[model samples]
Target: MIEHPMIETDRLILRKVTLDDAKDMFDYLSDSEVVKHMGIAPYQTVEAVHEEVEWYHSILKEQTGIRWGITLKNSDKVIGSCGFLNRNGKHFRTEVGFELNKEYWGKGVAREALEAVVTFGFKHMKLERIEALIEPGNISSQNLVEKIGFVKEGLLRHYEYTCGKFDDLFIYSFLKGDKTNRKSEH
Candidate 1:
């Protein structure tokens, strides 16, 4: 089994998610605005959130990926999550995904958490490429990735079908050893 480590930032903790976090996960996952560009429908029940949490566990067991619950340093409340998924060991690459509670938006919490995750992907997982697939309309996410040094790699038309329709996605990537991969002055 792949060991999951707790990653700490100045104001947040990236720890292994547990079923106890269901309510907190539901808070953001249930928000339509939070999940608007994620393709998945907003969760409608805590039970669904439990399953989502279980998926986090399964990925680790299968050695496919890792997901962490993002919590404030002063509280256990999970305001968001950031992690690597769709990992291709043979190719030394993986996809990154993250979401934050609306209440914490624009606070740099996601960036801090994501930077930690990206570090883990490159250092711990020894991945060479970290890709982020985001909907074209998700300007916030686009800006976040760009600020972190991911270069825009054009678009993938009708790449995903969700919420009853197909949506296009913009692909962005951060490769290992990129100068911008280090702590940014911003």
Candidate 2:
């Protein structure tokens, strides 16, 4: 499989990351509050961000995974990232992850990018299902997934550890032909 290349959406241009993106990455990932629920430590330095960017850059050629920068078409500003990771078994399934700059929260940016990514997952990648494991207490993420039609299957008891404690997770999945994605292909 080739890399999951850059993809465009109605309101966004999802581009593959580069080492050049270190500054942009650090602007968001270095914040403690931003990564509190993300299960990753707050990036401690620009060099750490650079290393992450480098990892994303390398993963493309390896055909192993994908991460894209979420750039608003109108602004061309790198607002966040959304990607598929932990791929397994000829890419039959994988988990999705995303993070947005706090300022853009509640402005529909996540929904816009998510719609595009979900469509890409089904159409371009030939995925059977894409899962979004969101923290149980993260009402904001739950609402976003619901708006996009990801069914809340249930909770996984102490599913993941984040911020140094066991966290409950809401299991949301979008199988191909799921009704919640009606507006995505638009």
Candidate 3:
């Protein structure tokens, strides 16, 4: 809760997002394609990114959630991020969200980061359920979560309003001790 705990995979390290990460974060966040489904419009400046970084830190400080800057193991530049947000302690559940620089897409970077975060959620955080809400048209995100073993729960009609309109989201979830999740943990 002090800050996001670092998590390492074979090729990446997930660590706390700092103000220094603004530029790198901005690199992807400013790309309309990268943030197209994220609700908010693409950021146009580092100042906006700095606000984002602060929000990441603030979530941790408030005990609501955590976000980790995803970086390659050999380099410090942030390429993406994956973590839990909207944590519900009483229900022992949380929602997971992730995004990567477009260049890193299709190379399994998001999967690797997500698997690690999912493991942390069930193990370190003692969560009973981890959910992912994907915009219906985002096939890649849907595929990623499915491949990671999350079961498709259903669709929530006009579940959220972001950007300028209402959007439908497909809800997917992985429960603690689920065989699929357990297999990925190892």
Candidate 4:
């Protein structure tokens, strides 16, 4: 089984999500603005969030992926979640995904959490490449990925079907020896 370790940053804690986190997860995930670029629709109920958390746990048990609940160092409230999705252990590659509460936007919290997650993926999970797929209209997320040193590869036509329609996506990637990954060592 893959061990899910809690990762800490200067101001945030990234740890396993629990059933108790449903309310917090639902708080942000229910926002249309937040789920706009995501594959899933805005959560309608806390029960739905509970189901989602259960799914996250199942994925961890299967060793398919790991999703960490992001919280402030001094609080138990989950402000967001970030982690590797579609992890391919044999190829040492995975897709990175994260979402933060709208209230926490523009505070650099997402960037800090992502940096720690990326570092953990490379150093602990031994990932060779971390990729991100973002909607063309999500400029904020696009900027965030680029800011973290992921190179924009190309636009994938009709890459994902979300919110009842097919959407194009931009693919960004970070390799093992990339300068940003190297700098993450410290």
Candidate 5:
């Protein structure tokens, strides 16, 4: 089994999500604005969040993915979650995904958390490439991925079925030896 380590950033702590986090996860996840671009409807109850958290745990156990609950340094409450999904060990590539509380939006929290996660993916997990798929309408998310050095690859038409209709998604990628990663080395 792959061990999930606690990754710390200057303002955030990325750790395994627990049952205790259900309430907090529900807090943000249930917000319409938060789930707008996510393609899913807002969570109706904390119980749903509980089940989702359990599913996240199962994915880790199956060694298919790893999801971390993002909490602030001064608080234990999870403000968001981020992780690698659809990891292909043989190809050394994985897709990164994250969502933050709308309350924390524009505060740079997601960027900080994502940087730590990407660093871990490259240095520890040995990932050669990290990719992100974002809906065309999610300008904020598109900015976030590009700010971190992911280059826009292309659009996948009718890529995902969300909210009852098929939606196009833009793919962005960052490679191991890219300028962003290389600059961090020194």
Candidate 6:
């Protein structure tokens, strides 16, 4: 199993998932509102949450997608998750996805976590493109993608069939050398 190195940013730390995080994972991941747009459904119990965490615990150290538990510096709490996934092509492209605890809604934590993951993908992992497939009407996530310079490619009509029906996914992307963040003074 190949392990992914931990990553850090100005205010967040991206670490591998462990079964010990079941408590924090259940807190947010079991919320229907939070999981509504996610690929996975909201967990029904802490046991269910642990089931999900266990899978990531194995995959995080394997050939599978890189998943991280997003913890904040000030609180040291796992507010949510964000990571690289769904790799394709000559190991040069992958998808990025994330979710947050409702308690942190309206905050810029998503961007902080996202930018760090994107930086890891490009600057370290060497991926050529990073994509986000957001559910329609998820305006908050849509705005976050655009703010980070990912252009709306188009709507992926019924791109995914989940929760017993077809769901439209918005395809937004950022190229490898997009120059969107090259001007940063930091």
For candidate 4, write residues 74-122 as lDDT tens digits.
9989999998888889999999999999999999999999988898888
Model 1, range 14-60, lDDT digits (tens) per residue? Answer: 99988889999999999999999989899999889999899999988
Per candidate, the number of residue pairs that clash is 0, 0, 0, 0, 0, 0
**Residue pairs in candidate 6 whose N, alpha carbon or C atoms collide under 3 angstroms:** none
3 or 6, greater by lDDT: 3
Kindly list the per-residue Cα lDDT of model 3 for residues 1-186, writing each as its tens digit.
484689988899999988988999999999999998888899999999999898888888887788989999999999988988999999999999999999999998999999999998887898999999999989999999998899999999999999889999999999986777434546
**Cα lDDT, model 3, residue 136:** 90
Give TM per candidate: 0.96, 0.88, 0.96, 0.95, 0.95, 0.91
Cα deviation at 125, candidate 3, in Å, is 0.5
- Candidate 2: segments with Cα more than 4 A from true spot: 1-4, 58-64, 181-186
Model 2 lDDT vs. the true structure? 0.79
Residue 44's C-alpha lDDT in candidate 2?
Answer: 85
Writing each residue's lDDT as its tens digit, candidate 6 over 1-186 gives: 576688777777888777778889899998988997886778878788877776665656554568788888776667798886677757588888899999988878888888878877788777888999999878999999898889899999988888888999999889987767522424
Regions of model 5 farther than 4 Å from truth: 181-186
lDDT of 2 by residue, 1-186 (tens): 355577777678998776667777788898877787788899988788887776666765564557889988886667789877765637577778889988888888888888878878788778888889998767888888888888889999898876788888888988887776546555
Question: Which pairs of residues collide in model 2?
Answer: none
Give the lDDT of residue 69 in candidate 6. Answer: 88
Question: Number of clashing pairs, model 1?
Answer: 0
Local distance difference test scores for all models:
0.90, 0.79, 0.90, 0.90, 0.90, 0.81
Once fitted onto the true fold, the runs of candidate 4 whose alpha carbons sit more than 4 angstroms away are 181-183
